[model samples]
Target: MGLSWQQGPLGAKAVGQFLTPEPFPERLLFVEPLRRRMRVRLDGQWVADSEDVVLLHEPGRYPVAYFPREDVTGLDEESRTTNHRDLGATAWFTVLEKKHAAWQHTDLPDHAKVLEGRVAFAWRAMDAFYEEDDRIVGHAADPYHRNDIRRTSRHLVVRDGTRTIANTKRPLVLYESGFAPRWYVPRADIDTAALKHVEGETFCPYKGLASYYDIGERKRAAWSYPQAWPEVAAISGWVSFEPDVVDVFLDGRKLVLEPGQGVVSHGIDRGLDPDELQERK
Candidate 1:
């Protein structure tokens, strides 16, 4: 979560409130410059490349990068029309026979003129998006987003009813932007018998894919990112329990999920198909 998505200041459930007299809009949209060189590739062809890009941030949505029309190429005439609740009529464009692969808000009001001459390509429609040599996965990188892991000696414990499923003195605490710190336990500290592999999975843009496990009668009581992204590779194969599902303790104190702490499952961004994400680095 950064700036707009999830629990950021512009998100619907912001962790902190704006101390203003006037009520904020029910839905807020922010447009700002993306000062990095962004390039798009499709079918071994360069579709768009721009150093002067703009990013649109709306509540509950990943930031969308818009490139200046002059920097883009191979876009055909508008193939379809749609409406953005705040941005008005939007024109969808096809590139290299990829129908409706890009869009531009052609009928923007004066307030949103900053995006008048720009178009944004659908992330999943393109072959790959690059910020220099690094291929960005899941979604565009939120500049304000951060993920940090810290090793701690806190007495972390997980329980299913009266049985202690996991107990550890050394655990890794993952601190992410605008989210609660998650504690990951070592695999050796957990009782392997207590975990029953569950069907289905989820993905994190920052942490790669997650596999779930059901403990006893509880469904999806624990999860682990077996092949986490290199940035957060320390917790690979380590398990993190759902506090609201099973009892968790840290430093001899019960860890209860407080109000507003729970978040909607982050199942990748921009409706990316799970099959397109198997080779994440």
Candidate 2:
């Protein structure tokens, strides 16, 4: 869960409500400058490049970067036209013989006027999206999203009823924005025999691709990032168990899963990045 998606402020289950005289609308959209250079690649060509990109944060959706039309090139407009309830009539564009690889809104209301002359490219359709020299995956990086990792000597233990699943004295605590802190245990401290590898996999924009494990009958009860993003690489190859599905104790205190902390990660069809989460890995 990040700032604008999932249960964050601008998400469907927002933690706070807007203060206004009249009842606020059920949905809220926030637009802000990315303040970084962004570029879009299509079939080995850099199609869009700009330092003046604005990101749109919509409820239940990943934040999207909208680039100034003047900064985009190497793309031609298509005949397809569609209606956008918020932005107005939308026109599609073709990139490298790919139809509808990009789009722009024709007219917008005063509140959304900033998007009138801007365009957004389909993330999966492009070869890659770059911030400076490094590439970004999953979706545009959420400026408000944060990932903090710290090494701790906390006594953490996991169990499935009477069977001890994992015991660890050294753990890394991951404090991600808008979610509960996750405790990742080093492989040396875990019982590898307890984990059963499954067929599913997930990709996190900040973290790397995630592979799940089943503890006996508990499906996807445990997970690990074999190749995590370099920013928070301390937890790479470490294991983490779900508090709601397994018993987890930290510093002798039993842990409980916080409400709204349950994440429903869908397989790629959720419009997740196609290739991988780690740009260089």
Candidate 3:
């Protein structure tokens, strides 16, 4: 969700934000009862399964699913950690000898009473997470986050310094929540010879896996959704450039990287030296 943390029902009661003086700015923290069957797997074994799950949506954060403790199994208490969250102290747990595999709120504020005794698993620590039969990718889907693709006739062009990499008259513009507009150019219009397929890939919950293209020395200058999720199938095989890495022009005007356009590198790429981009090649 694009909402701020203080805009939701428990916003005012959250420990960190609540301490601020009134008139408190509206933040958001949406907690909704999920009726669908949810399951968590670790090392190819089901660790938690529940029909009654709660989904928490915090601004700028991915949705997290909380399952009732009774439905979960095979967890051993590891240690207790003082929670800075409004939801009391936290008790950490390990699954199948995995370290810090999960945690639950030991105590909760009255406003967050619904989350009492519910456990939230670390998605990255677990082998897989499922809503029903299909595996959920990336982070949990944000119910409030949405993506829209619109066909546009505006001329678009991408360049790596003086080398023109792509040019197109028909472009697809994707409008996604909490992100700036991304223009996708037709593959036929791109200089295919200049694109070098990169080794790494990224995933999106709304969209499917993305393949990157290296423009000479500039790594990941452009990317394409080879097999996009059904919701955003229109952008499948269409190339989109990273505005911060390359020059993009629309309708004869040069485009500038707007605020929030930077992609936060995560996983193994996080905290590495900037020069590591060359090693990834």
Candidate 4:
């Protein structure tokens, strides 16, 4: 079992469905103060630095950090546009000729008054975003999303139709917020001959770059973190099967994909760049 959506200050469902209005039936927006020192870099220069930052949590979107206008530098007004659904008037700015690098609310609604005089940098446009010295990857980290990896002796098996792909008694169970527990099997216990390496990859901030494997025409049916982050080193070189793509069993009991585990496309991939890939090391 994973963490429930409503268990945290902000619901995990809201962050997962960031662009949908269904999760926010009340049409409410949340703004709260961020105590950490936040910084933004553009064009090889620090464009913004502030200890007093506010975070806006819009429905179906990751939290965005807004810095005090006075702390930002080298911004030129690019254009003015109406906000989405008339929330307010928005002003766009360019940082060092990077068009639409930042934006701010010029006309605030009663609910979004806290955003006044604050500017938010586009995560994809900026060279880097930081919470103090360490760089932040992907979108802003969701306060509600949590991940835990537990080592278990429970017998687990992965199969594709009648072919057994992996069988292990030592499995690592990864429990992430709003998702089902993913069982990771050790490489030694898996039949490597049954897996074919696939091209392209995906990155996870909490983990690292995930290398995919094909199981007899099942494209990307399994994934492994070859070089995982220090925090989740237990899953390094261990493979986890996509329950929806193949059959997974625990002690001979078949497992099914949970309701919220369906894959949904998101825009965070836009933030991935050569620099960001190189930063993984």
Candidate 5:
């Protein structure tokens, strides 16, 4: 019979026969070239440059790569650890292992699969902390979720003087629990002549780098940071847009979402969060 459960040394689930897990090598190189002296801290101990650091790619799990003994910042002989087999490989590393309920994939109900025509892929949001439950639980679109960032696209149609004009527009959505939703639009989608660069950039371990753009007459309209995590780099050209804050058009009409005063901005919310482990766990 096929393997039913593959548990790590510390009792976390490792791999299952039917699960779809990718190798860590599949990630994109860091936008700023990867540093040679890479060391990560695990619960206050340092695990340094050793040849055993192994990198693995995991979806939904943060820190896409799994570092071996040498790559960690704080790991030493004093750390009480165990080594064991979980299916085929030796599950190593003490401070880093998969967390419970953080990794589980059960087959979908057979009938639910038949009603939707055909589903190419099944996607779940990264961890509720990155995207909280108060906002949206999860959604499926096209073939991939990319970096777990939410996105919606529409073509703009407008009435110009006596003539009607049609323009294609795309917008990105960024939301946290109990916070206001922010929309970002591209210069091409809107009237770019009025938008100016704000001179700021932010980094997400899942999405990559982001630069800011502000609406000349309004505030920040759209921004794009070309470099992103290698796994879902396909959405690199896409920019985030604010739906309510900006007078941007979605398809033929302006999008009118329910005005919410309790929108949280951004941060890791553990109370309404999901499991995120950057290590072997």
Candidate 6:
């Protein structure tokens, strides 16, 4: 049977959810070519070539990159079947995890040790593993100026023996639902003397730029992914600190990050809302 397209509430919702006309940021376009070269070899077969995959995301779903059947080379012909189709003339591949194994071996790649202490990839599926450079990007497309909804609140205050020392309210909040929400405290609220300056930086296509500082005795300090969305450039928020390197506290309580739980690192598990997040954001 062939695929079909029906329009109504379903189509309208799909369009609203995935068809925003926001300008394609230059960084996003640059990463596209790299994606095609990124692929995973499972059971001696390559699956999900980034060149022709449909990336999807939702509230509680890991990003899904549906690949074309032709892109997946290996797997028995009997089980390889067409599931659905999309606007880009791409067909989705439906394969069983049990039918593949070579990629599931614990020691399939020895060079993996290079990432031993630093990063971990969570593969919930058997024979499922993503190649080293498999970075998939998702674009947020909605009719409502999602960025201007005004969902975050920021504060800067000094902790003084159970009392707030100096405090200021800044209307900057870094709230991205699927990812952790970073509450950016104002620069004035922080005790720069207590913060040991460090040289650390990271990038995000959605967010502009970022810089880090170590707080008190914490190895890694408050980070500000400074350049924010266009309409909310004034928002400078504090994203979480380096795991194990520092203990983050909101409202006097400490923030904890478990192994393999980082959004950018292991790519599995996310932190639920802490009462601190609600108060600070």
- Cα RMSD of all models vs. native, in order, equals 2.7, 3.0, 6.7, 4.5, 16.3, 15.6
TM-score to true structure, per model: 0.90, 0.88, 0.82, 0.86, 0.35, 0.38
Please report the TM-score between candidate 5 and the true structure.
Answer: 0.35
TM-score, cand. 6 vs. native: 0.38
In candidate 6, position 119 carries an lDDT of 11
Model 6: per-residue Cα lDDT over 65-162, one tens digit each: 33444555443323322321121111222243433221211222342222111111223332334434432222212111123224443443444335
Per-residue CA lDDT of model 4 for 1-281, tens digit only, reads 12123322244453344466555454456777888898988768999999999877665456788999999998999855658553578989989999888998898877677788999998889877888888877766656566789989999999899988999999999987656689999999999999899987777766777889999978889999887877787898999998778889999999887664664323334445645654656
Order of candidates by TM-score, top first? 1, 2, 4, 3, 6, 5
Worst 10 residues of 1 by lDDT: 263-272
Compared with the true structure, model 2 gives a TM-score of: 0.88
Q: Give lDDT: candidate 1, residue 56.
A: 93
lDDT of each: 0.87, 0.85, 0.75, 0.77, 0.33, 0.36
Candidate 2 Cα misplacement greater than 4 A, ranges? 16-24, 251-254, 262-281
Per-residue CA lDDT of model 2 for 155-244, tens digit only, reads 999999999888988889999987889999988888889999998788677777799999999988999998887888888899999988
Ranking by lDDT: 1, 2, 4, 3, 6, 5
Q: Candidate 5 local accuracy as lDDT?
A: 0.33
Q: Write candidate 1's Cα lDDT for 3-77 as tens digits.
A: 898789998889889999998998899988989999988888889999999999989889999999999999997
- The segments of candidate 6 whose C-alpha lies over 4 angstroms from its true place after superposition are 1-53, 56-64, 67-166, 179-181, 229-232, 236-261, 266-281
Candidate 3 lDDT by residue in tens digits, 1-281: 23322222333333233555665545455788877898988867899999999997765456789999999988999865768355668989988888897888887888888889899988888877778976665556556567899999999988888988988989999987666689998889999998899988764556766789888988888899886878898998999998778889998888877754445434422223323322322
Measured by lDDT, the strongest candidate is 1
Q: How many collisions between residues are there in candidate 1?
A: 0
